[model samples]
Target: MATEGIEAVFLTTHNWGKAAKFFQALGYELDFETDHNSGQLRNGDGPYVFISEIPEDQETQTQIVLKVPDADAFRADSPVEVVTPFEDTHYGTKEMTVRDPDGRLWNLQAPGKN
Candidate 1:
């Protein structure tokens, strides 16, 4: 299972307001917002980016969204230490991640490309 050029969305900003405006200027529309200071920005079709503010309790974190063909299968087969198990996301995708050797997490997102 493999993703067909999945858009690797990332959270690079600490301010959601500024980030939203910037992406909007760049043509990305604000689709939805998550409770945990996270939100999604969609451009056209695929590769919608997800942005989340740094939690006050948790230090700033950055995530790399990797496209997996079959998120469920990939999660079951992955060798890395799983942080968040693959499950149905609010934006309609199966996502999972593992903290890398350096503690950085790689977010694997597999939207239903069907």
Candidate 2:
């Protein structure tokens, strides 16, 4: 149930191209890109940066994605308040969200098989 460390930073932006360019200027290499203007970038061995186009109705926000050893076990043993139950993601990761005391949302993720 231990966390390895911060996995990625998820950013919702109105202009994905601009956001991606900004990160690229900062030396982030594009790892993957999708047709919807969503992609992942990496800088050397550091944590990844995931960028996605924000929906019209949603506000732009930044979310930190943490990598846990076992998301399922972490959720079951976590003392923090769960904001979302653990669920498998389309990217082949099991993820869940928990709210901090200050009401900040933290997303936890662990690698999973398809």
Among all candidates shown, the one with the greatest lDDT: 2
What lDDT score is found at residue 43 in candidate 1? 94
Q: Per-residue lDDT of 2-80 in model 1, one digit per residue for the tens?
A: 5566565777567887888889999999899877666889999978887888755666555668777776566456557
The whole-model C-alpha lDDT of candidate 1 against the native structure comes to 0.75
State the weakest 10-residue window (summed lDDT) of model 2: 69-78
* Global fold similarity of model 1 (TM-score): 0.60
As a TM-score, model 2 comes out at: 0.90
Q: Which regions in candidate 2 have their CA more than 4 angstroms from the true location?
A: 55-57, 75-77
The clash count of every prediction, one per candidate, is 2, 0
Q: Which portions of model 1 show Cα errors greater than 4 Å?
A: 55-61, 75-92, 98-105, 111-114
How many clashing residue pairs are found in candidate 2? 0
Highest-scoring model, TM-score: 2
